[model samples]
Target: MMVCRVFAIFFGNCLCLLLLLSSLADANQANIDCLKTFKSQVEDPNGYLSTWDFGNQTAQGFICKFAGVTCWHDDENRVFSIKISGFGLRGVFPQGFKLCSDLTGLDLSRNNFSGPLPSNISFLQLQHNQFTGTLPPQLAQLRRLKTFSVADNRLEGPIPKFNSAIITSESFANNLNLCGKPLDNCKMTSTNSHSKVVILAALGGFTVTAFVVGIVLGFFCSTISVEQLLFRKSRQNR
Candidate 1:
């Protein structure tokens, strides 16, 4: 009976270990799924990503050793960087990058991808692709961007606001109709105070107009009352 009990305990422990490993395996598969989704959306120039084989297993397989893909250090459960630029890729911008929360580097330059630029993609080499659209205002929220490039696309419009200082003037050139300081003379947008003042002035004008109309109406009524009283007295005298 003691031997049987020992065997059961060992089996239970092994089962627990297997469950833990399975959970980790699932997480790694999630990273691969995110990459696959991005591949479908972005147009690959020079067919750089055509060699990727997502069907393989993540561990002891070609997915882990896939070129241009660097997974997390100490573990293959997440992706770290994708530096494949100047490969002549052509397609629309990939919108599923938000799923890769741990991404640090993304090099998709010299590709033919076009879409509204930026949606909280905080990266260093994520630029240089063929993305075209109003500079997404959310890009200013990415606090980790460095050496960003969208300079040579069909992008246009006044530059949106952001908290980034690393970005330079060259990042936004050769566009359709971009106008601003250091480029053209599109007046920089006003601050919060300026917008508030404009709103207040419009409201104040309406209030003043209403007040003036009330005063004029009151004066006219007073004159009419006086005329009625005087007419009554004159008729009584007659």
Candidate 2:
């Protein structure tokens, strides 16, 4: 009975180990898919992404060797960040980057990517690009974002209010039409102007009413004083 119990314990340990390995394999596969989809969508005129070959599954951390990819470990397939600045990559924002579940830092600055940015990304360094359209309001929801910049782009409209001390006007420089906190306030709409006009008109009416009431009170008090003085003088004469 003791020998049977020992065998059961060993089997349980083996099962746990297999489960851990399986989970890691699934995560690594997702990372691989992220990179593959990103590469297929962009235009790499300079062949900067040519080293991202997926032909060898036998090699450990093969994806780590690809340019612009940063892995959590040299022998692991997990991606930590991707920085591919100045690569002249032209395309809309790559949506497949969401598959890299562990990605924390992303720097694609100085590229030719143009379009609305993805709202779900947490970190961004997309300056000097050709991206256009209003900055997505949903970006304010990324509370964990530590680094963000979209300067020198063609983007317009009210900038999202990201409540980060590190974010300042410099992070949004040269965007001709962007407005909000850390920048010029957005233009007041016609509705706001109308509200201001109504407020001023009410104040003016109140002031005119108060002035008329004051004059009436002053005239009435003067007439009462004159009557009292005349009555006293006539009583004294009698």
Candidate 3:
């Protein structure tokens, strides 16, 4: 009958729609879980990230439009940036930040984050915070690390060495006890050894060069004197 056939088609379509929706929901929840890991790590004052709504049933909505979050063009479901600067969040680095694999920018400046930066995050823009600790060299491991700034913090010790052109001396300025290249008087511990080795090697080279020159000069003078004396004695005998 036509009526029976219509019901069957309608039910089948509904089932397919439910399954598709379920799959999307699962992926969204996974992304939320990743974001939730970083929630407790920071101190949110103005609650700029309050709208994150980690428990929301839909994950695509998060990437589509979330407070202080940005997503990539081709990947709407994947976060690419989190700019929460000047929001008065007081805390250390967030957790599971690396979970946002497509993240290209993270601006946590003007907060009260007080501690060493997260090692996995290389391109951080922490303009102002209460951060205090030695710049961890582990951050240097981020080969994609392009920009780093922790100005106006209590961070001290050597500014972590990075081989990237994106980092420069001024990036870590306004902090206390930071030292290394590009910044005058902030020599890093690693560079000191290199300088010492260079000085010692140069001194050793100079000493060797002088010894060789002296030996050559002495050999020529001694030979000339012996030859002259022998010639004079031969001439006198003749």
Using TM-score, give the best candidate's number: 2
Can you tell me which runs of candidate 2 are displaced by over 4 Å?
190-238
Where model 3 places Cα greater than 4 Å from the true spot, the runs are 1-30, 73-75, 186-238
How would you encode candidate 2's per-residue C-alpha lDDT over 1-238 as one tens digit per residue? 9999999999999999999999989889999999999999999999999999999966778899999999999898999999999999999999999999989999999999999887888789999998999988999989889999999999998988788999999899998689999999999877999999999999999999999999999999999999999999999999
Report, for all candidates in order, the number of backbone clashes: 7, 0, 5
Sort order, lDDT high to low = 2, 3, 1
- Candidate 3 residue pairs in clash (backbone atoms < 3 Å): 28-59, 38-95, 43-90, 179-186, 180-186
lDDT of 1 by residue, 160-234 (tens): 665567666777767776666446777545676699899999999999999999999999999999999999999
Candidate 3, 7-37: lDDT as tens digits:
9999999999999978755655555555676
Task: Give every collision pair in model 1.
Answer: 43-91, 44-89, 45-88, 45-89, 46-88, 109-128, 113-130
- State the C-alpha lDDT per candidate: 0.71, 0.93, 0.75
Each prediction's RMSD to truth: 6.5, 5.6, 8.0
TM-scores for all predictions: 0.62, 0.78, 0.62
TM-score of 2: 0.78
lDDT of 2: 0.93
